[model samples]
Target: MDIVNALALFANFVAVPATAYGAQLALGALGVTLIFGILRFANFSHGELMSFGAMATILVTWTLQDLGIGIAPFPTALLALPVGILASIAVSLATNRMVFRFYQRRRANPIVFAIVSVGVMFVMAGLIRIIIGPDDQSFADGERFLITAFEFQKATGLKEGIAIKQTQVITVVVALVVVAALFWFLRKTRAGKAMRAFSDEEDLALLSGVNPDRVVQIAWIITATLACIAGTLYGLDKTYKPFIFLQILLPIFAATIVGGIGQPVGAILGGFVIAYSEVMVTYAFKKVITYLSPTDWAPEGLVQLLSTDYKFAVSFIILVAVLLIRPTGIIRGKVI
Candidate 1:
């Protein structure tokens, strides 16, 4: 049994997947947080928006592949990102104008808005399934690995090797860039300040000359952009399936709640926390144990807290815990 081997295996199982998954969750959580801040409600439709974005990117990637305009160092989906984001923004704006706008005009309660979002979710889900045929599709292409395990082993002359996938690297880079840009926009720009002011006090913001309708419109567009980027990156790293995005709702909700709804920084942290917890708890640790333990001391059973099938349950448990202990969330987000 070697401690070095055990650490290596643990790093592979817990660290790598956690970082990758954390990025995806962070992206999703950002969208949820933005909507909560500006729209003043929990948008249940966000999961489907992400699905729609991913589906759009997948379709575009397929088209590009057919046209033989493939990316070499990155996935073709990366090239299709701007188009997918634009399409998502357009769809979101249209939905707001046609559906949610009515409710806003009526000055509907937050609960009513939540219910409306649910209806929108269903519609978007159906549309995605119809367009994508309810099947799983891989959108990843070009360089698969940034650093292959064999290459690492040969270079370092170590028994253990590290393999970093190109998609994983790209996902992290893109998320960082997007997040930085978002923060800059929110903190530095006049529209961003107006958005914050609106979130702080809608009536006051209106009195201060901020156009309520315009703020709502901008929020929807920004939320849609975030969803598109998050969804596309997740699809590139994993496979694109309309149903999987639906399943992502729980974790995204958990992250939003844990971080304190409407707090962007908290959302990011919550995303990473939830992602690591899920991956670490569900991941089988047999390989890690075998690498570390002596033959006689190794356990017979797999060292996993729960099966992957119960991942959603894990998120729900966390959500319940947070609600019971601190309903306002870690950052004390707006109760509304």
Candidate 2:
């Protein structure tokens, strides 16, 4: 019974939150990986792209709420997600056409493109701040928890009960669906094959009659979809803040590099790894340890490796370690 309680406590604090967070990170990393693989540049503006999507969704959600509209069991943001995705796609396409097109035509080096993307990141960040302000936006609505701690305790007769949020479950389910669809598209669709071929060998793919412009468009569209979905889901789970997205870019980049930048599966795997590391490092395990211990004595300390405020440092440490130990990443992706 004590062991079970300990497990329940662990699940409540570490597993569930980490799983949801990992799903969000995976989605964001997928977009980063796709851009790197297809566009041959590290898009520093990807985080701002996420912010832009969430901002759009939040605005739509506010409009709907003002009109007395809601989905009850689900967040109204779900209804606004399509609009957010469309907005993100439009911005992505516009940026590509106006800024990146000239560089592409000039055959600019990847580093130059990366630098340009940093500039774009600042521009998009400014735009998002101008539109949404720098305050946290609470757009989440509908059901709050799938199972509250009290409910779980009453049902299971356990001292430690798991509390599962509705958003956590929804985030996981949506991530699975999106990832499956993306993989299928890449594996079974004609355009997906062309994109893959282009990533593998640009000159050869062009010679094989693959339309470069069409491929680039598809890549941007897919990237925008992934980024928008990820941002909205994350905001639903937490609070939406324009500046937070910029900070989140670190973990996303870390996940991308740790998972192998060009490998989708690696990105997903790395997301889970990074998420678990952050949660576990910051979580206080004193209660779980005391429950599992045979004696009644408890540890004086919190038994946390690090404070929650420094959680992002875990990702940074892991990222630096991966770069030093395995530059190609766990799945042996392309070197940065």
Candidate 3:
């Protein structure tokens, strides 16, 4: 029973939360990978795009709530998601037409495009900040816990109890559904094939009668949809803050690079790897250790590898190591 308690404790603090976070990161990384794989540039504005989407969702959720609308057991944000996605798509299209397309037409270098994206990042960031203000906004509604610790303890009769959040389950479920749909679309759809062909060889795809403009439009639209879903889910799971997205960008990039840039499967794998690493490294193991130890013994220290505040540093270290040792990542994906 002590062993069971230990496992329960570990799951409560580390496993469940990490899994949800991993799913969120995977979605964000997929958007980044898609843009890079197709457009051939690192988009520095992706984080701000996420912020904008989440901001839009939050605003719409607030409006819906004021209008006495809700889904109850689920967040109202779900109902507002479509509106947010549309807003994000509009901004993304406008950005492509007004900013990125200019560079594309001029045949700018990838580095130039990356720098331009940074400029766009600042602009989006400022806009989001102006709209949402620089503070954490809580918009989550409906059920908070799928399984509370007390309920779990009563059911299992274990000293340690696991608590699971509804948002965590939703994040994982939605991410799986979205990823499945994306993979299917890529494998079976016409536009997906065109996008893949364009990514592989632009000239060849054009000669094969693929429409570059349509492909580019589709990529941005898909990316915006992904960013909105990921952002809204993340905000629901955690809290919506204008600055958190910027901080999250590092881990998203790390996940993309570690999994192998341009490899969707790699992005998913890398997200979990990075999530588990950050969680396990920072998590205090004293409780689990105490539960597993002999009857009267206990450790004095927290037995944590690092503090929670340094979690992002773990991603950075892993990213650097991967870049130095295996630039192509775990799956030998395209080198950036």
Candidate 4:
């Protein structure tokens, strides 16, 4: 009974939150990886793209709320997600048209494109901040917790209880749906085949009659949808802040690199690994130990491996290690 309770405590504090966070990170990383694989350059502006979509969603959600519209059990943000995605797609397309196309026409190097993306990142980030300000934007309506601690305790008749947030559940469900749809599209659709063929060999694909422009356009659209969904879900889980989105770029990049930068499945795996590592290391195990051990045997220390403030550093360290150990990544993605 004590062991079970201890595990329950761990699940309540660490597992559930980490899973939701990992799913969100994976979705965000997928956008980054897709762009890198298909577009042949790292778009540093991805974080800003997320911010743009999330800000758009927030604006629309506010408008809907003002009109007394809501989804009740689910967040009204769900309904506004499509609007956010479309806004992101427009921004992506416009940038590709005005800026990326110039580089494409010039046949610039990948590093050049990367440097250009950094400039675009700054411009886009500034625009978002100017438009939305650098404050927390909170607009969520519906159930708060799908399973409360007290309810879990009552149901299980255990000393320790688990609490799962509604947002967390929604995040997992939505991520699974999105991932499934992406896999189906990529595996079964004609355009997806063209994109894959292009990624495999540009010259061969070109000779085989694949349209580079169409492939790039489709990639941007998919990347935009993924970014927008990830951004909105993250904001719903936490809060919408322009600066926070920028910070998220670190973990997202880490996830992408660790999981094999160009591999979709690797991104998902890396996300969970990084998330669980962060949560487990930072979470103080004192309570769980106390529940498990005899009263007198309980430890005095918090038993946390690291402070929560150092959580982001975990991703950096892991990323460096992966780069050093296997440049090709765990699942054999693009070698960096």
Q: Which candidate leads in lDDT?
A: 2
Whole-model Cα lDDT per candidate?
0.88, 0.93, 0.92, 0.90
Model 4, range 219-335, lDDT digits (tens) per residue?
999999999999999999988888888799998999999999888998998888888988898999998888878664877899998999999999989899999999877889987
What is candidate 2's TM-score against the reference?
A: 0.98
Candidate 3 vs 4: which has more lDDT: 3
Model 1 gets an lDDT of 0.88
Question: For candidate 2, lDDT tens digit of each residue in 250-327?
Answer: 999999999998888999998899999999999999999999899887989999999999999999999999999999
Q: What TM-score does each of the candidates earn?
A: 0.95, 0.98, 0.97, 0.97
Top candidate by TM-score: 2
List model 3 lDDT by residue over 165-209, tens digit each: 999999999999999999998889999999998888888999999
Model 4 score (lDDT): 0.90
**Sort by TM-score, best first: what order?**
2, 3, 4, 1
Give me the runs in candidate 1 sitting further than 4 Å from their true place. 289-296
- TM-score for predicted model 4 compared with the true structure: 0.97
For TM-score, candidate 2 versus 4, the one ahead is: 2
lDDT of 4 at 17: 94
Sorting all predicted structures by lDDT, with the top scorer first, yields 2, 3, 4, 1
Any idea what lDDT model 3 has? Answer: 0.92
